[model samples]
Target chain A: MAYELYYWPTIQGRGEFVRLALEEAGADYIDVARESEGIAVMMRMMDHAEHPPLAPPFLKDGDTIIGQTAAILLYLGARHGLAPKDPAGGLWTHQIQLTIADLVAEAHDTHHPVGVGLYYEDQKAEALRRSDEFCENRIPKFLTWFDTILARNPAGDAHLVGRSLTYADLSLFQLVEGLSYAFPKATGRALKQAPRVAALHDAVARRPRIKAYCASPRRIPFNQEGIFRRYPELDR
Target chain B: MAYELYYWPTIQGRGEFVRLALEEAGADYIDVARESEGIAVMMRMMDHAEHPPLAPPFLKDGDTIIGQTAAILLYLGARHGLAPKDPAGGLWTHQIQLTIADLVAEAHDTHHPVGVGLYYEDQKAEALRRSDEFCENRIPKFLTWFDTILARNPAGDAHLVGRSLTYADLSLFQLVEGLSYAFPKATGRALKQAPRVAALHDAVARRPRIKAYCASPRRIPFNQEGIFRRYPELDR
Candidate 1:
């Protein structure tokens, strides 16, 4: 059976991270919410699955319903040669993935600072302040950290973990892409400060499978509805 | 060799989750930063280690330096028998740990909505508003999810992942403990709706090793500087 991935149909959001890894590996998986009965299957899992997932962007492979984007990638990474097999290498790769998660959450909070359910207009002032601080402080801090990691990677800066690409590399590509889309001007400045990181993003984009996926309709464009929302007022 | 755990000495913060795991498993570990020269070791790793950790609360076992509280727990969980042996069970355990991390971050944000570097006094207005939404919407949503997971657990409601104790149980205990201290009124009310979660918190506390650790000077008191800071105005 093809792996079942449940996420919102319209927004790439957290699901994009998992999708990128699956795409990069050319894994057989269904973007369930995009399927004919995807939404219903997702709803049933949310409502009544034996091991109900805490949220969407969960992967269902047989009996397991894996939630948390990082966890799903971690599961897939080992199986697909996208993660290290050695214990220490695996742990280091996971540590990097968790940091990427932190960056993603902060990106989401830049737009929805006060409340997730509230409209951006309702939290406009807070969102603006949050976004400004995020662009100035958080973006540089996180990007610089990643740049440092890449610089210090004994294997090479081409991949985050070891010689080959791992889920962390895929996730970092999505992070840069989302940040670049969400805050074009600020991301450009940050990219200049972290050239190696910029190079890695380019490298991941150039991967044949990744290149094909980017051009395919399967990859959703950044919009106001997703985590990396482009609000003119919030981003300078 | 004793695991070297490096974190800020004063605050329980994220490190406490790791401490709780180490304590519960009867694992020999050194709280590196709590020692006189501990801060320097942690600073050196941040500044100059070959694989510099993104932040503190990193664990040094032999040569591997693991960062991110959840990542640290994931590494220790298996070795200490604090996590499951099976692949699916381990993944599920880790998924719960990641969700607990989400809750911890939200708790931190409730007090620092505007900027992390800024003092809570500087961002009191925004913190007040953020905490209100957090306490009302986010807290209930997260707690209710945990409650449902516990209710639906086939192993037992006594633990988050399986019949055996996991690092997730230790972290959830700290979460409930922090919430109770920081938002007594709101947490008191939230606990009423999540009796199973509340029970797990109580059960973890009563564990002999955990009980001794809490009673000893090892367990730091909850303070304003930590993730679950008490600001009377924000809590109510």
Candidate 2:
């Protein structure tokens, strides 16, 4: 049976991370929410499923449902050879993914500093202040960590763990893409300082399956509504 | 060999979640940062370790170093039998722990909405607005999810997963503790509606090892500087 992925229909959001992995592996999966009546089906699953998710972007494989992007990736990564087979190496890859998740959460908070419940317009002042700190500190801090790990990898700087392509590399590509889209000026500066990270992002982009997925209509374009918004004023 | 746990010495913060797991399992471990000159040692390790943690609350077991609170717990949970042995059940436990982590991050943001670099007083206005939404919506939404899972558990409503104690139950207990300390009024109301969750929190508190750990000075008291802080003005 093909895996069913349920997420918001319109934006890349967190679901895109999972989508990238599935696409890269050529795994048979359905973007459930993108289908007709999918949103209702998604919400009802949350309401009545044996193991309900607190939010969207959950995956149903057979009778097992997995939620939380990192946890989902952890599941898929091991099964698809997208993570190391050794327990220690696998755990390290997961640790890196969780760190990426921390940065992603912070990135989302830049545009909604006051409350997720409030509109961006209502929280503009706070967003401006938060965005400044994010661009100045958090982005560089997180990207530098990635660069450091890539440079320090025993195998080489080619991948985050071992010398193989893992989900972390795919997700890193997505992170850089989101940051570049959301804060072009700031991401440009940070990328220049972290060449290994920048190169890895580009390398992942060039992967045949990933490249095709990007060119295809299946890949959702970044917009103001998603986690990484291109609010020009907030970028600088 | 004794496990070495590294974290901020003064506050319970995220490290407490790990500490609770270690304590409950009666695992022999050293609180590295609590020893003299230990913070310097911890910082140096982050600077040079092959798998450097982005931040503290990292655990060093033999040569393996695990970071990220949930990731650390996942490692400890398996070895210590604090998690289910089955792969599917283990993943579900991790999923719940990750969700709790999301709420913990949100809870931290209530006080530092503008930036982690800025002090709470500097972001007081933003904090107040954020706290209102957190208390009114986020708390109930998260706690109710826990309650729902507890109620829906096939074995019984006593634990978050299976019939045995998992790290999710311990972490849920800590989450309730932090929320109750930080937003007593809101948590009180939320807990009233999430009786199963409330009972789990109480039950974890009374567990032999956990009970002793909480009473001993080994457990740091909740203070203003940690992720969860009591600011009466924002609690309402």
Candidate 3:
């Protein structure tokens, strides 16, 4: 059976992580929220009393409902043989993915620092400060950390964990891509100093599957409603 | 060799999750930062050019270094035979743990909405609004979801995923306990409606190992420095 992915219909938010993996692996999956009457079906699934996902970007495989981007990716990666086969390598890949999830959360908080329910206009001042910190410290700190991992990898910088493509690499690529879209100025400055990480992002984007997915309409564009938003004030 | 845990010495922060797993399993480990000259050693270790942890709350088993709270728990849980034996059960357990991690991150952001490096005093206005949203909406939303999970557990409400105790239950106990301490008014209001979640928290705490840990000095007291801070102004 094909996996059912439920996320916000209009945004490439956290759900994009799952979409990327499924796309890269050429897996059979349905983007539920993008279809007609899909959002209502997704909301109904969430409102279910039993085994409902805590939030969106949940993947349904048969009776199993999995949420959390890292968890969903881990499930898809393991099932589709996208993660490392070695136990230690697999665990390391998961660790990196979780860290990426942390980065994603931080990125989202930049605009909604005062309240997720509040508009960016309502929380502009708070977002200004949050984004300043994110651009000045958090982004570099997280990006450099990924760079250090790639530098330390015994299998070389071609991938995050080992010699082949892992979900971590794909996620990192997405992370950098999102940052570049949302905080172009800050990302450009940071990426210059983070050569290895920049190289990895470029490599992942150049992957045949990822490139095809990027060019396809199936890959939704980033927007204000997404985790990473291109607000000029937040970028600088 | 004993397991080595590296985190900041003062707060019952993210490190507490790993601490609970270790304490519950009676695993031989050292809280590196609490030991002699340990904080400096942790700083130095973090500064290492090769194989350094991206952030704190990392575990070192001989030469292997694993970071990320959920990742660390997954490692220790499997290693100590605390995780479910079945792959499906294990993945479900991890799914819940990742959700807990998400809640923890949101909780932390309530108090430090403007910037992590900034003091609460520096961002009081932003925090006030953030905390209000967190207390009024996020807390109830997260707790009610967990309550629903417990109520719908196919095996039983005795555990989150199955009939047996899992690390997710322990983490949830810590989450509720922290929420109670940090946002008593909001938590009190929510718990009244989330009886199953409250009951699960109480049940997890009543476990001999967990009860003992709670009573022990090893369980650091939650304070303003931690993720969940008790800010009277923020709570109401």
The lDDT of each candidate is 0.88, 0.96, 0.88
Cα shift from native, residue B67, model 1 (Å)? 0.4
Query: Native-vs-model 1 lDDT?
Result: 0.88
Where model 3 places Cα greater than 4 Å from the true spot, the runs are none
Candidate 2's residue-wise lDDT over A99-129, tens digit each? 9999889989999987788999999999999
TM-score of each model, in listed order: 0.98, 1.00, 0.97
Off by over 4 Å in 2: none
Shift of residue B161 alpha carbon in model 3, Å: 1.5
Per-candidate interface DockQ score = 0.76, 0.91, 0.78
Q: By descending DockQ, how would the candidates be arranged?
A: 2, 3, 1
Chain A: TM-score in each model: 0.98, 0.99, 0.98
Candidate 3 C-alpha lDDT tens digits along A78-110: 888889877778888998898888889899989
Candidate 1 lDDT, A1-236, residue by residue in tens: 78889999999899999999889888899998898988998999888865677788899888789999999999999989999899888888998899999989999888778777788888788888888889898888999989998888899888888899999998999999999989998989999999989999999999999999999999898888999988877776
Q: On residues B1-236, what C-alpha lDDT tens digit does candidate 2 reach at each position?
A: 99999999999999999999999999999999999999999999999999999999999999999999999999999999999999999999999999999999999999999899999999999999999999999999999999999999999999999999999999999999999999999999999999999999999999999999999999999998899999999998
Those runs of model 1 whose alpha carbons end farther than 4 Å from true positions after fitting are none
Tell me the deviation in Å of residue A107 in model 2: 0.9
